[model samples]
Target: MNYNQPTDVLLIDDDVVNNFIAETLIKRASKHTNITVCLNGRDAIEKLLSIKQESGKLPEFIFLDLAMPVMDGWKFLDEYHRLNIGDGSNSEIIILSSSVFRRDIDRALKHSVVKEYISKPLNIELIRKVLKIDHHTN
Candidate 1:
C-alpha cells in the first residue's frame, strides 16, 4: 500500500452518463485518482483479471451497479468471490445501485467485499463523507 501512488477507482455500470458523472465527481474529490469504467460486470471482471495478471495491482475502490446487461452485480460478486483474485481487503467495494429494496441492500451487505451500499446518482458529498476521501491532494 504505497500512499504516494495514485488511487485507482473502478466503476461498473452500463449507463454511460452515470459513468461520466461518477468519473467527474471522483476527479473533483481527488485529482490523483485514476478511474476505470466498465460497461458491465463481465467487462469489469475481465479488466480486473487483466490487472491482476499484468501488474498484480487491483483498484483501490470499486463502485458497482446491480443492474447491467451482460452480467449484473450479483453475478459479478459471485464470480468475484469464486475467482479470489482480489485480496478482499485491498479493493474496497461499494454498491452504487439504484435499487432501494431492503433485500438488495441486505444481500450486498452480506458480501465480504462490499464495504458500503449507496443509492445511485453519486455525488461528491458521498465520496467525501461516506467514503471519507475528503478531496485528497498531494
Candidate 2:
C-alpha cells in the first residue's frame, strides 16, 4: 500500500484538548493534510453524508474517538455501516481512544470499517506510522 499522506482527514473527538493535540500532531506529520474536526459522532456522520452527496468522495482518513456524547463511536459505526459510503478503498477509519480494555480493542478491530486502533494522546510518530508517511525529511 502506498504510504503517502492523504489530502483530507476527519477527526471525530469530543474532547477539545484531544482534538487540538491530534490535529497538531497530524499537521506535524504531514503539512499537506486538510484536517476537519467534529465534536461528536452525530455531526461527523452528518458531515460525511453531506460530503458524499455533494462531492461523492469521502475523506481520505478518519480519526475517531470511542466515547462521545450525542453518538459514541460504536453507534457511529453502526450508522456508518448503514450508509455504505465507500468501496473500502477511499476512506479509512482509525479508532483513537483512551480505552485500553481488550474487549474494546477487539471489538473495534473486528469491525470491517475500522482500519486500526490507537490509544489516546496521539503523537507525531503514531500519526506518521498510521498514515504510512516517511519519517525522513529532505
Candidate 3:
C-alpha cells in the first residue's frame, strides 16, 4: 500500500487511553491518512454504515478491538461482512487486540474482511509495518 496516498481509517476501541495512544502512533507512522475514532463496536458499525451510505465508499482501513460493551469486534465483523461492506479491493481490515490466543488469530484470519492481526501496546514499529511506511526518517 502507498502510505503517501490519503487513506481513511476507522479505529474502534472501548478504552480511551488505548484509543488515544493508537491514534497517535498511527499519525506518527503516516501523515497522509485520516483517522476516525469510535468508542465501541456498535457506534463504529453505525458510523461506518452511515459513511458508506453517504460517501458511496467504505473506509480504506479499519482497526478493531476485540472486547467491548454493546458489541464486540467479532460481532462487528459479522455485521460488516453480512452487509458486504467492502467495495472490491479498496477496503481492508486490521484487528487490534490484547488477545494472544491462537484461536483469536485463527478466527481473525478466517474472515475475508480481515487483512491483518495486531497485538496491543501500539507503537511506531507496528504502525510502520501496517502502513508500510519507511523507517529511515525515524
Candidate 4:
C-alpha cells in the first residue's frame, strides 16, 4: 500500500505483542507512516503532552486499548480532555480492544474523541480502511 501523505500513529497497548503487530501492520500500510508505541495510557498521555510541548503537535492517529495497567483508555480520555491536550479534530482516536461486549463498543464510540472502534489483531485491511485508502488503488 501507498500513502501519499505522511502520518504519525500512536499505539497505546499494555501488550508488547499487540504493539509489535500494530506497528508492523501500520508499516505495511504505509512506509512513510511513523509509529509510536506506549505500553500504558499514562505513558501515552505523558508522551502526547511532551510532544505537544516540544512540537505543538499530536499524532494523526491513536490506536488505544481499553484495558491497560497504570491507566486505562477511559481514564486516559478523561485526562486528555481535562488537560485540553490536542485539538481533538486533528487526531483520530481509534479504540483497539479485545472486548467483544457491545456495551464497551457503544461506550467507546459515544466518546467525542473516539473516531472508531475495532477489535484486536489490527490487520492490513483494517489499517487501510482507517487511513481511508482504497486497497485496490493503493
Candidate 5:
C-alpha cells in the first residue's frame, strides 16, 4: 500500500469484543491504515461529524452494526445521507451485522449511503474483498 494513500476506517458496534475483533482483522488485512471504533451509531455519527468539522478527514469506510443500542444502523444511514456526504467519499458504510434476514438486507439495499453488507466475525479475506470491491467501484 502506498504510504500517502489514506486507509482510515470507522467501526460502529455495541459489542466491545466484536469491535476489537473487527479492528484487529482490519489491521491484519492492511497494515498501513488507521481504524477507529464507536460503541454505537450515535457515537459514530458524532465522531464522524467532528472529524469532518475539525480535519475534514472522514474515514474511507465504516463498518456498521444494525442491532445496536442507543442508535441503530438504519437511523445512522438516515442521518448520514441527510448530511449529503456528496460523491460518497466522506465514508462508505457497510452493514456488518449478524442479521441474515432478507428484510434486513432489503432495507440496507434501499439506502444510498450503504455500499454493501458484511457478516460477523470479520476476516482478512473479507477485508481484502471489500477493498477490492471498493477499488473497482470507485
Candidate 6:
C-alpha cells in the first residue's frame, strides 16, 4: 500500500488522548487524512452501516481496540463477520490495543478478519507496517 495515497480508515477506541495521537500519526504516516473515530464498537458499527448505506463502500482499514464499555472489540468482530461486512471489500481489521498478553494476541490473530495485532501508542513505523507501505520507497 502506498502511504502517499489518501484512504479512509476507521478507528474504534474509547481513549480521547490515544485517539488524537493515533489520528495524527495515521495522517502523518499513511496520509490517510480521512479517519473516522468511534468511541466504542457499537458506534463503529453504526458508522460502518451508515457509510455502507450512504456510499456502498467501507473503509480500507479498521483500527480496533480490545476493551470498551459499549460493545467491545471482540463483539464488534463477531458482528462484522456475522454481517459479512467485508464480503466485497478489502477491509482489513487490525487489532490495535494496549493489551500484550499472549492469549490476547493469539485470540486476536486467530480471528479471520484481523490482519495483524499492534500494541498501543501507535507510531509511524507500525502504521507503515499495517498499511504495508514500502519502506524503501519512502
lDDT measured at residue 120 in model 6 versus the true structure, 0 to 100: 83
List the candidates' TM-scores in order: 0.92, 0.92, 0.91, 0.93, 0.87, 0.92
Candidate number achieving the greatest TM-score relative to the actual structure: 4
For model 4, the superposed segments whose C-alpha errors exceed 4 Å read none
Question: Candidate 6 residues 1-138, lDDT tens each?
Answer: 655667889999999999999999887776555899999999998889888889978998999999999899999999888887777888899999999999999999998889999988799899888887765765
* lDDT score, candidate 2, position 105: 99
**Candidates in descending lDDT order:** 4, 6, 1, 2, 3, 5
Output the lDDT of residue 119, model 2: 93
Model 4, residue 38: C-alpha shift (Å) = 0.5
Writing each residue's lDDT as its tens digit, candidate 2 over 47-84 gives: 99898889887888899999999999999898898877
Candidate 5's C-alpha runs over 4 A off are 1-4, 85-90, 133-138
Give the alpha-carbon lDDT of every model. Answer: 0.88, 0.87, 0.85, 0.88, 0.80, 0.88
Residues 25-106 of candidate 3 have per-residue lDDT tens digits of: 8888777779999988889888988987898777777999999889999999888888776646467789999999999999
Which window of ten consecutive residues has the lowest lDDT sum in model 3?
A: 83-92
TM-score result, candidate 4: 0.93
How badly does each model clash, as a count of residue pairs?
0, 0, 0, 0, 0, 0
Encode model 5's per-residue lDDT on 7-116: one tens digit a residue: 88888899999988888877776767798889888998889888887888778888899998999988888887787643436567789999999999999988877888
lDDT of 4 by residue, 65-125 (tens): 9999999999998898899886644889999999989999999988888999999878999
Which of the two, 2 or 3, has more TM-score? 2
User: What overall lDDT, based on C-alpha atoms, would model 3 receive against the true structure?
Assistant: 0.85
Q: Which of the two, 2 or 6, has more TM-score?
A: 2
